[model samples]
Target chain A: GESVGLHLPTLSVQEGDNSIINCAYSNSASDYFIWYKQESGKGPQFIIDIRSNMDKRQGQRVTVLLNKTVKHLSLQIAATQPGDSAVYFCAESGPSGYSTLTFGKGTMLLVSP
Target chain B: EAGVAQSPRYKIIEKRQSVAFWCNPISGHATLYWYQQILGQGPKLLIQFQNNGVVDDSQLPKDRFSAERLKGVDSTLKIQPAKLEDSAVYLCASSLAWTQFYNEQFFGPGTRLTVL
Candidate 1:
């Protein structure tokens, strides 16, 4: 059975501060991991992705780190803004390409302005 | 480039009533997927189609749910005799065909369903 879960259900941060969200997965066969940001009433938007071959990946203001040994994943947002307030989800696809992605229970990131 | 399209934006129905949702994937995408997102939870896969054929429907509740993709393009998902537990947001997403290492799934604004 493949399942992904987040360590925290809600993360609150002051404006302009940094935020870190963590996730853990049960499947070792997962090869690809992605982070998505979802605003109220909107779909989850792609933020960044990291592959098992790589330990870390960076985007405009976000970063995703993969720890295969612990089967853990993390997303970091620097200088978090009010606009960044939303639910963030981590998803994973397996060693096989074109496989169904398993998504973790999202973590709501509330950035206070 | 347009993203995936789904309708109606919202629906309210009573339990035991039937409902259906329509989805149009991004042009040229070979894979289409439907997901159910309950409040406070991540999206769960309902069904997947690689063109007009079914690739996976393992998580789908086949007893009351049904879906189809004709001509490998547009798709529809239907639930007969809906239950209160069937209430959730239905999301549609698509991705380009097998392209080696990168296959990004573009999602559409989902349809919010409420069964009272």
Candidate 2:
């Protein structure tokens, strides 16, 4: 069975510090990966995504690094703020036409001011 | 553009009761998805629709769950004779189309269901 999982259950960081959340996926066929942020009582919001063809992708304040050799993925947030506190999920999808996403157990990111 | 829209922000029902949730995807989007998010976990895909047709429903509990997407627009998911373990958030998401490449899915504020 294919599974995606986070390395940490929770990560606490101080404001103005950097945060890195790690994930491990078991599916070698997974070509598309995405990161989502979910606040309390809200749906998951898309943050950043990277394709298997690319190793790194950067958004406004976030970066996603994918290591195919180890099947590891990481999300890095710069200058973490209280507003960035939420549960972060890493999802992977196969190379099918539908591309159904399989999400991992989330990592709670707590940024304290 | 408006994001995905869902109704009944919250619901409370007893075991064996039935509940239905509604969702309206973004305009012109051809793909819709339903997911269940348990506490402290990530969302799991339950069903997927493409233009009023069923693309995938392998994860959906067929004995207790049913969904329909009519006219290739709005969709509704129903759960009959629910169980306590069914209590979770039902999220609806939509994308422009079903593709092999990156097609970002926009999600709606999910409906929280509590089964007592």
Candidate maximizing TM-score: 2
**Candidate 1 global Cα RMSD:** 4.0
TM-score of chain A of each: 0.90, 0.91
Give native contacts recovered, as a fraction, per prediction. Answer: 0.45, 0.62
lDDT of 1 at B1: 90
Q: Which CAPRI tier for candidate 1?
A: acceptable
- Which portions of model 2 miss their true places by more than 4 Å? A1-8
Highest-scoring model, DockQ: 2
Q: Candidate 1 regions off by >4 Å? A: A1-8, B99-102
Instruction: Estimate the TM-score for candidate 2.
Output: 0.95
Best by lDDT: 2
Cα error, candidate 1, residue A23 (Å): 0.6
- The C-alpha TM-scores of every prediction are 0.94, 0.95
lDDT of 2 by residue, A6-71 (tens): 343889999999999999987988989999998877788999999898999999989999999999
